[model samples]
Target: MEKKELEYIHSFAEYVDRFIRLLIDYSPKLVSALIILFVGLYVIRFINRLVRKIMVKRELDPTLSKFLADSLLWALRVLLFVTFISKLGIETSSFVAILGAAGLAIGLSLQGSLSNFAGGMLIILFKPFRVGDTIEAQGVVGTVLEIQIFVTKLITGNNQTIFVPNGILSNGVIINYSMQGNRRADLVFSLSYDTNIKTAKDIVMQVMLNHPKVLKNPAPTVTVRDLTDSAIHLSIKPWAKNVDFGDMSSDILENCKEAFDAAGIVTQPFVREASKG
Candidate 1:
């Protein structure tokens, strides 16, 4: 054999030896890392199930409970990842620093979402409103159906669904009709000037008082509000529980119409004047 060929063979053997030694040295670390990963995953699942059970037992608010659970899950996952890396004999400080930097970048990029998350947390903490409450805010009046981390879902009177961002909802003015448990309805009725004011008042007042939903403590009131050229406007104010407000107002109006007609009290609906010929 030539001297060059022998040297080439010797070099190939040296490379193979180094490769085998490397495989032997690193195999245990790799296996340990894999084992740690699988075990960590199982523990995470177990912890998640336990937390869910605790939340159910405590009857915690669904949105807040979900947020807490997810936060815990991600934290555990990050810790597990760090442990897996360290088990593989890799330095963790630089990896941790990299993770921190990446997290900061992601936080900055998702500023709006983070703000919404914070708003949701505040809502859960302070409880300005809750699920199933009827509220009016940002020009939308509806019942709260669901409150999530970033957005809230509302179902309006006409059955239209609305999605309002938590950031806006928390920061803006919220009028929770259900919070106080009662609401006042302001209604106006028109009558011809020729109609007897006392009789008209009695008929409308009777209708409101007879209604089962109207609260007796506040008592319904009927007062002459304005004197127009064509008619007299009577302001009718009734207080009812929030749950009964809609039905009570509708019932009062309908019953008042029937009563007014029966008593010969004429309610004049104003009409727009026609253009002169």
Candidate 2:
């Protein structure tokens, strides 16, 4: 029994010695790896900040800038992790292969999401519209609230929130009404055939030109657009700042009605001619 106990103690000492030697052999490499990881992390953070500053200076879209910074940081950190593991004498080929396989599986499962991400990238690179801009697309007209990777948020005139997929939005036609600082208000008014066309045109033009919100540079125009059996159609076009478009148009329409009524100019409805047998 004493001999067995001595043998067990000797075996335990040998195990401890082997562990000490392994630790000594690996200690320097582990310390160096840790230092490299810390430095790499710091460098990555610095690069991310630098990139963000540059993006801000270049006036890149905020949403896109953040996405790019995060993606770059994650990629660099992943590379750093791989380097740290390799420094510890760990094989990385299999690790990278596993990551690749996992990425492939995720990609396959999120094909639609990937498409939206691509679409978002395209939108950021080539901006068709910006936040706060009024746009018409997907049979909806609304102001852009937020631009994101998967979807864009819009607030309609009726105050409804809509989430539009970036994939469809990027592919479809986007009518940005606020791209131009000024917008033209096209209004059509009909007067009775008995009312002089020239008089009606002059009245509408006077109202448009005298409006405070209408731009005077381009000059508002009121021209005879069509001559119907029961009425004379006049097209009134006035230019105004985009922000004041609604108010300007509404005021002009109301003013025209009041002015026509005061001048005894009657608005008439279109009358179709009877088909001859």
Candidate 3:
């Protein structure tokens, strides 16, 4: 029994020695890997900050810039992970293959979402329209409230809120009305054939020019548009600041009514909302 105990102690001692040797052999590798991980993370954060600063300097859209910075951060971290694994003698090629396969699977499963994400990136990058701009698309005309990564929010003239997915918006045609800074209103007036055409033209022109909001440089024009069996039609074209476009139409129509009544001119004038694309 004493001889067997001695043999057991010897065997335990040998196992301990082997463990010690193994630890010593791997300690340096483990320490280096840890150092790289910590340092790589720090470097990634620093780079992300630098990229964000650059984007700000370039005046990139705020939402788009943040998205780009986060994407770069994840890509860099993935590369650092590959390097970290390679440092520890892991088969990096096999790991990369696994990552690729996983990515492909995920991409397939979320193809619709990916398409929307891609569309969002394009819209933000190209800036076909911006928040606060009045736009017409998807059978809706409204002012843009927010431009987000997945959807754009709009407030319609009737005060209805709308959310449009980036995928459909980017693919469809958009009409931006505010980009021009000014809009033209076409007011049509129909007077009885007996009414003096020259008097009607002068009245409409005076109303458009005397208004404070209308642009004077273009010189408002009143011309005979069409003659029907019931009346003679005249088109009154005036330009005004985009912000005042809707108000301008209402005011012009009201003023024309008062003016014609006072002038003893019998006429009916109607205005159409400015159409733009």
Candidate 4:
């Protein structure tokens, strides 16, 4: 029994000595790999923080700053990962080359999406339009909801959301409806052909002038714009603050009735074509 115990101890000692030697032999490589990994991670994190600080200091848009920071961090971390792999005695040159080639192929295949991404970057940097701004683009007019990396979201007056690619938005003409501070309201009123043209114009002009919300600085213009076969057409032009446009429009039509009654001017109904029986 004693000899058997001694043999067991001897076998255990051999096993411990082999493990120690193995650890020592590979210690330098393992230590170097660990140091490289930790330092790379630290540097990447520091640089990411630094970039965010600079972006905040520059007063970049929150969405844009977040996107840019994430993209930069991802790129840095990928590079660090490649370096870490190399430190572990892995030949990553071919791997990197393959990744680059694949990326290029994918990018080429998705040129439209890539263009949108680039255009989105330009939009964020240049800031042609911002969230909540009313704009007309790509035959869609709405308020901006979000400006993402590849697309812009808009909420229409009808409460519909639209996603427009940034490529078309940036490349095409964008009419910022809210940028001009004020908007012009143009409305046409048709009166009976026999009705007094002068009276009709006077009534419309008076209605516009009396409106409280209407801007008084730019005097409203009322004139006989066209003469149809059945009616005398009068055009009413007024300028009002953008925010007041809808309110003024709704009130103007209602006020015209009172003005016309006071002036004794009558309007005619539009006639529709009759189909052949």
Q: Pick the candidate with the highest TM-score.
A: 2
RMSD of each: 5.2, 4.9, 3.7, 5.7
Residues 1-277 of candidate 4: C-alpha lDDT, one tens digit per residue: 6999999999999999999999998788779988988998899899999999999999989889999899999999898888877887789989899999999999999999999999999889898999988998999999999999999999998999999999999999998878877877777777777677776777778788888878887888888767877777777777788888888977887788667767677766541212211
Model 4 alpha-carbon miss at residue 241, Å: 1.7
Q: List ranges where model 1 is wrong by over 4 Å.
A: 1-13, 227-230, 270-277
Cα RMSD, model 3: 3.7
Please name the candidate that would achieve the greatest lDDT relative to the true structure: 2
lDDT of 2 by residue, 148-250 (tens): 9989899998999999999999999998999988888887887888898888888888998889999997789888877877678787888899999999988
Which candidate would rank higher by lDDT, 1 or 2?
Answer: 2
Ranking by lDDT: 2, 1, 3, 4
Instruction: Report the CA-based lDDT of candidate 1 relative to the real structure.
Output: 0.88
Worst 10 residues of 2 by lDDT: 268-277
Off by over 4 Å in 4: 1-23, 270-277
> Model 1, 1-277: lDDT tens per residue?
9999999999999999999999999999999999999999999999998998899899998888888999999999989999998999999999989989999999999999999998888988788899999998889999999988889899999999999998989999998999988888888788888889998998888888888999998878989877989898888888899989989888887898788888887888642222212
Query: Clashing pairs in model 2?
Result: none
TM-score (C-alpha) between model 4 and the true structure: 0.83
Residue 55 of model 3 has an lDDT of 96
- Which ten-residue region of model 4 has the weakest summed lDDT? 268-277
TM-score of each: 0.86, 0.87, 0.83, 0.83
